[model samples]
Target: MLDLALEIAAELIRRPSVTPEDGGCQDYIEALLQPYGFRRIRIDRGGVTNSIFLRQGERAGCLAFAGHTDVVPTGPLIDWPHDPFAAVVENGMLHGRGAQDMKGGIACWLAASIRLLRDGVPIPTMQLLITSDEEGESIDGTIHIVKHLQSHGMLPDAALVGEPSSHRIVGDTVRRGRRGVMQVRIRFDGKQGHSAYPQDADNAIHRAIPALHRIIDLDWGNPAAGFPATTCQITNLNGGTGASNVIPGHCDAFLDIRYNPANSADEIESMLRNACNAEHVQLEFDRVADAFATPDGPFLDSVTRAIRDTMGIEPRLDTGGGTSDGRFLAKAGIPVAEIGLTNATIHQIGECVALEELAALSAIYASLIRNFEVNG
Candidate 1:
């Protein structure tokens, strides 16, 4: 299983599939799963890339493993010891793009799925969901795959996202939920006029300042919403010309928001508009991901038990981090838990994964699959 995991991981990192690009990584994944008996479901709706592969066991429910095949672009190649897509392994550390950030998790998970298939003992249906977009402009990916599933009347009983979650020793931590993410791009308008004739035109900068401060300072996170104290951050603000004397005609600010599940995207937008009482302000929203919380259900317990059995540690369920594909599944109303290698080096230049952890994760996943749908 470890060999298979490494093979898959190395094969993937070699593909160089940066965000919004498949780079044939999806093809490789589908081919690898085909020999293992999983049926692939392709979904290409309006330029989005997503696929779901399913393997059924005769058990009473369904279990899913989800991951993104995309990796964030390697910022600058100079800092890396070798090519980011090289997938070089040395001294027990595998280094490459997506090595720690997550291609490793996907590989380990696929290995487990194959192992479960080899066992040939009937269990619940198992699905593998892999997407080609996650690191940028996530316009499609998980949500699209899920929408396709919903349209086809196929939803899972539970899911496990192979996102990098462990912080220290493998299995020491597992993220059970994630905070929601919301962003707004607002444009404020005012009549253009000369600097000396400021009275002739309303300064959009002046008109927008008070409202921007209010919205930026507004607490978006609410306890009842199951999140930390929500706060809004203005990422970009522009209003003035090169000439300091000119009072710009238009002001624009980009806002990013992360809240909890209790508030809908529409509610957050309304809240922002109401708080930002600027006249002629235009708002555009992006990927308003809702928060997710996986209850202590059968699937959660199975993962915990699997971790303890494999790694000799009791895992913790946490809910506080940036968004992931897990939110997509949670929105689909499936109970989910996360388990994987330490994330200390994720998205870093070296981005490596511990070999032993990979083995342990595969073991844990296999154990969980065997025990899946079992009553507590």
Candidate 2:
């Protein structure tokens, strides 16, 4: 299994599967799964690459594992200690792009599946959903995959997303859920006039200032679990087109909201609408991901027990992060949790993973699978 882990990670790194590009990363995974008895399903919708492979069991519900193969671009390759694609193992760490953020995770799953198959274990059905569009818009990855699952009745009872959730140790933390994300583009409209004649026309920037303060002042983090309330921040702004003398006709700002579970999407949308007022400002929102809370039920209990039994410590339940593919699966009401390697180096040049954690995570996954069968 360790050999498989190392090999797969290197092979995956060789492919430059950046956001929204498969880069043959999914194809490499399918090749490994095919030899092991898992049925690979390539799900492409509207030019998106999301592939799923399943190994059916004689029993009932499915145990699903979700992850992405896409890696963020390796910026200024010279910063890396070794070739990001070479996948050098230096000082007990396998260094490469996507080593920690993902590929490491996918490798662990592959290793676990191999061990499970070799053990002749007979239990619930298992599924693996992999996509390469996570670092981008994420619209074509897990979102479309979940929709495909629903239409064909492939929704799993529970899912484990292989996101780099642990802050320090491998199981030190687990993400129970993620805050919903909304990227808003607002355009404040006003009549262009001379800067000297202040009363001739409205200044869009001046009108936008108050609304910006209102948005900045809203609480985004939740009180419970240290989760902040609906977090709103202005990411970018543009008004005048170079000439200082001109009063711009339009002022634009990009706002990002990471809202908590306490508010619905409609509620947040209404907040934006009301704040914009009728000042001719156009408020447009494009949802990146929805907020999902993990249930404290049998599924979670089983995973928690498995982690404690293996690591001798209970993992912390966290809700901090931009988003994960789990966002889509959680929409089905399945309890979702993230478990993976340390995330300190993800998306960075010379990204790496501790080799020991790779082996440990694989064993941990296998143990969890066994525990799920026994507890179920």
Candidate 3:
């Protein structure tokens, strides 16, 4: 099983799939699963590639594993010890761009599923949801797959997202929820004039300072349990006109807010509206990702039990990540848990993962699949 996972992971890492490109990763996955009776359903849209590999089971209930084939852009090639797309394995580590972030997780899941099938183990129907639009704008990725499942009445009883959620060891931590994301673009307008005469120039920067201060001071209240307080950051601000002597006519600011379930997007927008209430100020809000949580139940119990049984350690049920494709699955009313390889090196220049992690994660996934039961 470990060798199978390593081979698959190495092949996927060598594909050079950056951002919205699949790099033929999905095609390889289809070929691998086709022989195992898993049928692929394509949900391509807006240039994004999405696929659902479904296999009917002899047992009751359905299980789904959601993952992405896309990886973030590799940084400076000279900075990396090995080529980012080479999938180097040395000193017990698998080094590559997606080794920890995602492709590794997907490979482990596939290994576990295939191994179980080869052993003739009776398992629930399985669905592997793969997309190539995760690391980029996720407008037409898993969300589209979920919509298709809903329309076809094939929603799974539960889903496990392969998002590299572990901290120290594989199976040591599983993400039960993630904070929401809201990006704001604020434009402040004023009359541009000479800076020499304050009376002749309306300083838009001056008008923006106080309003931005209010936004920073806005109370987001307390966060929900197992979650952190909401955070708002002014990521970008520009107001100067090239000439040091001239006052800017307009100021542009960008805000990135990460909020827990304690605050809804609507409420946050309202608060921002009140803060920047001037007629000249315009605010555009985009609810990029909505906060979601999977309450403790049979589904979570099964996940924890699988980890404990396989890894011989108590798993920490955490809710402290920026955001993930799991939110889309969770929003569809399915119990969702993110369980995967350790994420210590995700998105780093020399991103890598221990080969042992692949084996352990594959074992945990196999255990989970063997003992999974739908939560009422």
Candidate 4:
């Protein structure tokens, strides 16, 4: 199982699938699972590649694994010890761009399923939801696959997102929820003129200061249990001319808010509008990803038991992280748990994972699949 996982992970990393591009990775996946009786269902949308691989089970209930084939851009290739897409194995580590963020996780799940099937294990029906739009806009990836499942009434009983959720060790942590994302683009308008002629100029920078301060001062209140408090940050601010003597006519400010379930996107938008109350200021709000949490239930208990049996350790149920494709499934009312390899180097220049981590994670996934149950 370890050898199979390492081979697949290396092959996947060899494909340079930078955001929104499958780069033939899913095609490769299809070829691997086709011989194993898994039917491939394509759900491509807006040029993003999405696939659902399904296999009927000998046991009752359906289990799904959600993952992405896309990887974030490798900034400054020279900084990496090995080529970002080479999949180099050095000192027991598989080094590459997607090694830890996702592709490694996907490989482990595949290995586990295949091993179980070959060994004649009677596991539940399985669905592998793969998408290429996660590392980019995330507009037309898992969201479309989820909609298709809903239309066909084929939604799985539960889903495990392969998002590299663990921190220090495999099975040490599983993300039960993630905070919501809200982005706001605010434009403060005013007349542009010379700095010397202060009376003639309606400085946009001057107009933006008070409103920004008000936004920063807005109360977010306490967060929900096992979650962090709502955080609003002014990520970007631009309002200047080339000449120091010029007073800018407009200032654009971008706000990125990660809030727990305690705060709704609508509530945050309302508070923001109240802060930037001037008629000259225009605010555009985008509810990127809604906050979602899977309450403790049979699904979670099963995952915990599988981890305990495989790793001999208690796994922490965490709700931290920016966001993930799991939100789409959670929004569809399916219980979602994110369990995967450790995330020490995800999105870093030298993103990689240990070979042992893959082996352990694969074993845990195999156990989870063998023990999955449906709510009757």
Q: Which one is best on lDDT? A: 4
* lDDT tens readout by residue for model 2, 149-243: 89898788888999888888888888888888889999999989999997997899988989888777665434334356677889999998689
**Best candidate per TM-score, number?**
3
Which whole-number lDDT from 0 to 100 does residue 136 have in model 3? 88
Please state every model's RMSD to the true fold in angstroms: 4.0, 3.8, 3.6, 4.0
Deviation (Å) of 150 in candidate 2 = 0.6
TM-score per candidate, chains pooled: 0.80, 0.82, 0.84, 0.82
Please give the distance, in angstroms, between residue 324's alpha carbon in candidate 4 and its true position after superposition: 1.1
The local distance difference test score of each candidate is 0.81, 0.82, 0.92, 0.94
Per-residue lDDT of 1-376 in model 4, one digit per residue for the tens? 9999999999999999999889999999999999889999998999999999999999999999999999999999999999999999999999999999899999999999999999999989999999999989888999899999999999999999999999899999999999998899999999999999989989999999999999999999988777889999999999988789999999999999999988888899999999988889999999888998888789999999999999999999999877888999999999999999999999999999999999999999999998888961
Q: What is the C-alpha lDDT profile of model 3 across 1-376, one tens digit per residue? A: 9999999999999998897899999999999999999999999999888999999987899999999999998889999999999999999999999998899999999999999999999989999999999988898999999999999999999999999989898888899999999999999998899888889889999989999999999989999767889999999999978998998999999999999888899999999999998889999999888998888789999999998998899999999877888898888999999999988889999999999999999999999999987653
Model 2 per-residue lDDT at 260: 76
User: How many residue pairs clash (N, CA or C atoms closer than 3 angstroms) in each of the candidate models, in the order given?
Assistant: 1, 9, 0, 0
lDDT of 4 at 304: 92
Runs in model 3 deviating more than 4 A are 76-80, 185-218, 233-255, 274-281
Clashing pairs in 4: none
At residue 310, give the lDDT of candidate 1. Answer: 84
